[model samples]
Every structure is written in C-alpha cells, then in structure tokens.
Target: MTSSRSETAYQRAVAAFKNPTLDLLHRRYAPFVVSVLSVMFTAERPTVPISDAHVEVGTFVEELRAAGYDLDERTLPNGTGRDICRSWARVGWLVPQITDGVELYRLSAQAVGALEVAGRAGGGRAKVSRSRVRTLLESVEQLTQSAETDPALRLARLRDERAALDAEIALIEAAGDELDPIDDDQLLEDTENVLHLSRELPADFVRVAESINAMQRDVIAELRRDERPAGEVLREYLHRGEHVMEATPEGRAFAGALKLIGDPEHIDHLTDQLQALLGKSFAHLMTPEQRGELRAIAKRVEQGVQEVLQAQRRASHVITTQVRTHDPIRDREVDELLRSVMSGLQAWVPDSRAGDRIDPLRSLPTAGVRHLRQTVSDPRPPTAPAPLRDPGEQAEFVDADTRAWGGPNYAELEAYLAGLEAESFDLAAAFAGIGDAETRRPADLLGLLEIAHRNGLVESAEVSVVEALRPDGTARRFAFGAVTARTLKVESHD
Candidate 1:
C-alpha cells in the first residue's frame, strides 16, 4: 500500500477508536462499567427506570467499595451514580428516553456493542469450531447458488443437494432404528455458535433504531435551513418517511430480518425447532445460559423487530408532523438569531472570568416616564386629643349578650358555687348541674376551675368529664383531673 493509503487507514482506525464503543472499553473503569451494565440490562430487559438505574448503580458501586476495589476519585467517576449516569449519557454510552411517561436509561448501540464484545470474551467458546466453519460454508454456497445467472448451474447445484439428501435418506432407512445421532460435544458446539451469532442481533437492531432517529433529526434540521423550496423539501422528507427502513445499512438488515421473522409462522417454526433441539439427549450437556439463550431466540428476534418498527413509526410521525407545521422562514430566522447569539458567546467566553455575571433580559425595559410621584401625603391622623366618655352615660351591656361572648363570668360562677350544698363537690357535677346554657359554656369550665382554686379546691388523680355548651349551640366534652371545691367561700362585694 502507498504511504497515503496507510495514513488514511490509520486515520480511519483512530476515528473508529474514538467512537463510544471502543472508548468505553478503553476507559480505566471499563470492567466496572461493563459489569454493572451487563447485570442491569439483559435481553429480556432493555430499559430501567432512571431512578432505579441510579440507585442500583450506586448500590453496585458501594458493593465494589466494600469488596476492596480501588474506586478512588481518579479511578472512578467523580459524583454519585446519578451523576455518573448523566456523564455516561453525555458520552453517548447510555440513552435517556421516556417510555410510558417514565424516564428510562437504555443501552445505546455503542454501549451494546461494547457489552457484546465483553460478553463474548468471557463466553469460553472454542476459538474455531466445526459448526462455525459449516455455517460459513453453507451460507457462502447458498449465496453462490442464488446468485448464479445460468439456469444450468442452478439445476446442477440443486441436483447435487438432492443426491446428498437421497444418500442420507438411504442410510437412515438401512439403519432403521439404529440411526446415528449427533454427539453431545458437536451439538453443544453448534448451539454455542448459533448463540454467538444471535448475540449480535440486539446491537444491530439498536443501531437501526438510532440511525432512523438520526435521519429524522437531519431531515428536520435541513427543513429548518430552508435551502430548498418547501414543496421540494417536503417531497424529499416524505420519500424518506415512506422508505425509512431502507435509509441505512442497518435499516436494510432490519428490513431483511422482517422478511425472515416478521411472519408468525416463521417465529413459531423457530420456536418449535428450538424446543425439539432442547429435548434431545445432548441438550443436557449445554449450560443453563446456553439453554436459556436458545429458548429466548424467537422472543428476542420478535422484540428486536418490534423495536425497529416502533423506531421507524416514530421517525415517520416526527417527520410528518414537522412537515405539516413547518415554517421555514420563521425557523430560519430563529436559527440565524440563535447562531448569532452563540457566536457572540463563543467570542466572549475567552475574555470572561468564571465568576462573571450578566443581568439577564427578563423583560423589556420599562417605558421612560417623567414627573413621577416621589412622595405621598402623610398617613397620620389629623387629631389625637379625646377625653374618655362618662361611665354614667354609657349604655349597660345586656347580661345574656355579655355572657355569650365575654370571658368567664367569675361572679356568676362564684354565686352558683355558693348555692351548692356541699362545701366539697365534684367540679364536673357542679358545672353540669347549671341549667343555663351560657353558664355551662366551655369558657365557664375554666372560670369554675379558677373560682375553685381561689376558694380552696382539692385536686385528685381521678378522671372527670365535663360537657360544656358553646354559644353557637354546639356542645364539647372535656376531660381533666378531678377537682373538688373545699370550704367554698364568696368574695365580698366591697
């Protein structure tokens, strides 16, 4: 190769390494990240609620810390798991999405690729197996026969396959019940090979989905640019929307996968075949992981297909809606203004200090006004001198009205207590004996207690209940320590 070619290849390699997939694996804490992600996400479960992911990641970190792992500030992320996840999102390892109105963390295509490599490295499969070679040979042979232009060559290939099948049939018939079965070792190897191939499907699906999303974003951006007429732009975008699944290589693969697994019968056939395989005598030789992978093959394919379809639908919907409500002129104007502002900030950033402040334009400046009032009239009263009213001329308050709203009638309660026969009586009973609703008011209870204390009352631990009436005609029951008036006396009216 020429020096230019070598440099070009090296530059391309460097660019590839800079991608998130390789960058993640190259990080210092890559093992930690991979282990956490692998455990948190699996084939059956792709997304975790944002809060749950944060908590689980935090707990895992704590466990690592307890396990004596070197997770210092330099070795580990600087903040809590939430911050770490946000950082991962910024670096494109995790994609934040909203599903069912809940924010979730899903492995991005790049993250999935990293995980796939990590998982394969630890899978303990043979470096090269007969099953792997056979699969490649069969695939290439089929491709060759399918691509053959001459009908004679195609017929010859079909004849050869038929001859081989006839021989196998004859051998089986001759063996009768003694037909040879595949060895457990070979069976396990083949299953593992199949699993190895299946593992790439999820990452491929994610790539397609992400590609479609990216295409939508690009289309919208181009529309906003208004470089072309609206009709022309809409036509281009509409065509993309209709053939969204064919927009990218990954999307094209997704389209082919749809042909294979989109049909219910195909999925059912795959499931049946898997079940029959598991029922074989050699199946027991496979690990639980292998068995599980085999069982979920059909389900995983369906899920991946659905995910890609949903992504395509989402893209179409977004692109269509953007086209319908598109205002190229306004969008272009806004885009230009934003670019200008960003350019200004970029220019100003080098001269700005960390603590520099700018008063944000929260609202338009107030209109200029002249001759505004600076002071108001004084709020003080005009006069303050007033003599007290003569007591004789004041109208007397009615007793009933006074009893309803005023504080406890000490004099009334004292007279009522004097009317009681026993020098010592339960305060509750005395208060209850009063027939006047006003006198039996809740406030009157306090008055009775105060009057009892003044006239010498004995307190006991025994409980007491007093039902008092309010002026609003509602009754309230209060419970307190028992109070018994002793040597009750009336005050002088001096």
Candidate 2:
C-alpha cells in the first residue's frame, strides 16, 4: 500500500515489456519466426525438429541476409535461424525439449497466442464469425452463473441447466437414435473460434512468463538495496519471492494455469478435441498456423509452463551469484598461506617471509614428456601391392563353329600371317605347309583360316589355282582351293 511498494510493483510489471522475447518475435526475427511457424504447420506433427529444418533454415537465413535484413556477421555463414529459435525457447516462446535424445522445438502456448495477434499483422482484418458473438455471450453467462453466491439464485440456475439437459435427452430418445445434427454454420464458427484460442495460447504464456521474470528481477533489486545483515537479506529475499507468487496477479494466475497445463488428463482432452475438430469438414475454415497450433498445443503448453517455472526459480536465488560470497579453492590456499606467514612471524620476523610475491608456478619444477626411441615399424614406407592371379581360362570361340579352340590363337595366327604380311594372297598350299599335313585333318585347315579371319587378318577369299607346298613336308606342286589376303587398310578410332 506504500508508495515505495507500489513503485516496485509497477516496475516489475514493466519488466515484462523489457524482456527481449517480444522484441525478437515482433521486430528482428518476426519474418523468420513467422515463416518457420508457418512451415511447421505444413507438418502433421506439432514439433518442428532440426532434422527436418537444417537445410530449410539455412536457406532462409541466407535469403534473409541477401534481402538486407540486419543479421550478425557470424550468423550469415553458419546460419543462426536455429539459434534464433533457441532464443525464443530461452524466453519461453518455444519449448526446447529433448525427446529420443534429439533436441526438438515446439511453439509454446505463449507463442501460439502471439501468432494469433500477429496473424493479422501486415495483413487485413481477421475473419471472425457472426456466431463468435453467440459463443462469447453463452460463455459469459455460464461464468457469471457459476460464480453466483446466493443459494436461491444458484439453485434456480442449476435447475434450468438440468431441465435443458433433460429436454435434449428426451428429444434424442424420441428420435429413435436419429439425433439432430448441429448447424454447419455454427459448427464452422465454433471451429474457427477454437482455432483462434489455440493461436492465442502461446502469446498469452509469453505475457505470463515475462511478468514472472520481471517480478523476479524486482525481488532481486529490492534485496540488493536492503541494508540488513547477510542472513537477514537472504531470509527477506526468500520471503519476498514467496509473497510475490501469492500476492502478484501474474504469479497467481500463472501458477493456476501451469497446474492445468501440466495436468495429463487436461492435455489429453485438449489434444483430442483439437484433433476431432481438425478432422471435421469445417476444419478448412482454419488457417495453416492455427491447424499447427492445435496439433502441438498440448505438448507446447505442458513443457513451456515447466520452463517458465524454471526461469522464475532462478530469480529466487538468495544472492544470485555464488562467486560473490566464497571460493573453496581460494579460501583453502589463503588459509594455508596465512598460517605459514603467522608461524614464520612467531618464530623469527615478518621480514623473513615477506617478498614482493612468491610465484608458486615458477618454483614448481620442470615438467616435460620424453620420447624414447624404439623399434617401431615405419608408417609412411612405400609398399608394393600383391601380384594378382589372372582371371584364369578366358572364354574362346570362333564364329564359324561356335566352339572353343576352334580357332588358332594369336601366336599361331601371327606366325602364319607374318609370311603373308608381305603378300595380298597365296595358294591354299601355303596355309597347308604351315601345319603338318601327315597328321592334319580338313577341320584343321578350316580352323586355321577361321582364326586368321576373326582377328581381322583376312580381307577377302576366293577359290583360285595356286602352287603350294603340301603339309606332307615333301616338295610337291598342288592345286590350292582357296586363297585369302590380309586387310591392308586400318580404321582409325579417333
């Protein structure tokens, strides 16, 4: 009630606006955050994990920088869109949760709410239904009747609700299971309203978290100004922290909301209702962001409230800095040094132990690693590869017989062709002499010529009279049946 107390309370409330969360969302990263949230809406799930967004966020950051957005120098190369999202989580707009060992992000209830408000940003008026008024009117009536204190009024209101319920039940029974369906327009309007609420949740939480933080900061500032003893200041800090939670409007409402959000059954019911609404034909009335918010609403709210609680708890610290009061290592070393100096003073004089400073590190003796030479294999030595065995037994066939070994090999054909390499063609006797006629058969004669022809050694062949040495190894003239010539022309590949 005092002026000082009122000023302090006002300052705490103002701290909510001081938080950088709202600034980042609505100012610096507004376009990026909105784009991200909008993209997440395209997914069937509420969470937008980094796995699905590394490339997407990278590209977005690059494009934004190109468009002359004021991004940090380091962020341009590495793409800090993810870091920007993390900042939102730090401020309670997004819940940074680890599930399945992966850090995932979901829009907090506060973020959803902000999006709803911002949904109309840079755009035209929002589309609210005519039935939205009807829904709000009915909601106000229910809230007012539920809060009635007079016994007579409460009883009359309860009786009316029961009568309406009974009438609805009678109609359903009278219809023989053919219940009247809800009007499509009303359903569409309600669906849109639900979507709107889903959007508002995240934004609402942002306000709550910011307020809690502001109140926390105010508590610390007050304690810092307190001139009481250290113990008294700590106790006062604890007391003020507790009082704020109980007396502050933001604190009271946030505590209640956190409880409701954390309730498993409440979350399940909200999720189920949203899913059911989305499944309806009327779901098309909602925007992409609204649909995404509905899908992730339960999870975001649950985790986001927990994170907000953590931030508030951090603000409850007595001194807020451990380094200010003590240091275990430093104290022990100082105690030892004091004892040593005092003992020296008692034994001799203060001048004996006194010096500019004793460099503890300097007198500590040398430390070095010695490497001893040992017989170790040379790691960089060049080594030859193991000789590979041939593929072994390559396939061989001649087009004439379609059988293996039905042709002369390169060696046999090479020698036979070298003699005719100087001539176009010769009598068949020349080929006959190349082999032993006494042991050779007709197939041998045909196979030798086939091998030569296949290797591109033959150009043309004809039946002609020619003098030749017989295979019998005797000097005798014979009429050769066929003569062939080697191909004198070569084809160029290139």
lDDT of 2: 0.60
| C-alpha local distance difference test of each model | 0.85, 0.60
Q: What is candidate 1's lDDT per residue for 1-494, written digit by digit as tens?
A: 45798899999999999887888899777887888999998768878999999999898888877787754654555568998889888877899988668999999999999999998888765568899999999999989988899999899889999999999899999999988787889988899889989988888899988987887888888877778776787687778766867767777888899888899899999999999999999899988988998998888898788777887787777778987999867887888989999998999899999999877889977878877999999998899969887674465766544437668978788788777777688888889899888788888999889888887888889999989998888989999999988646666787
Q: Which regions in candidate 1 have their CA more than 4 angstroms from the true location? A: 4-19, 71-75, 329-333, 336-357, 365-494
Question: For model 1, what is the C-alpha lDDT against the true structure?
Answer: 0.85
**Model 2 poorest ten-residue lDDT run:** 400-409
Q: What digit string (tens of lDDT, one per residue) describes model 2 on residues 1-494?
A: 45698898899878876654455454555656776666664324556676555556666777777897645643333446666555656766676655557877666655665555567564456576776787788999989987888999989988998999999888888998577678767886666666555554445555555565666665555444443444665676567666654565656666677676667788788878778878987668667856666677666676556656655665554246732553456655877888998986576654555554443545656768598677889887498878997653565545442433333344554455555545455436555556544223344455555654664443334554433333333444434445454523334478
On lDDT, the leading prediction is 1
Q: For every model in order, what is the number of clashing pairs?
A: 0, 11
TM-score of every model versus the real structure: 0.67, 0.47
The residue-level lDDT of candidate 1 at 243 comes to 81
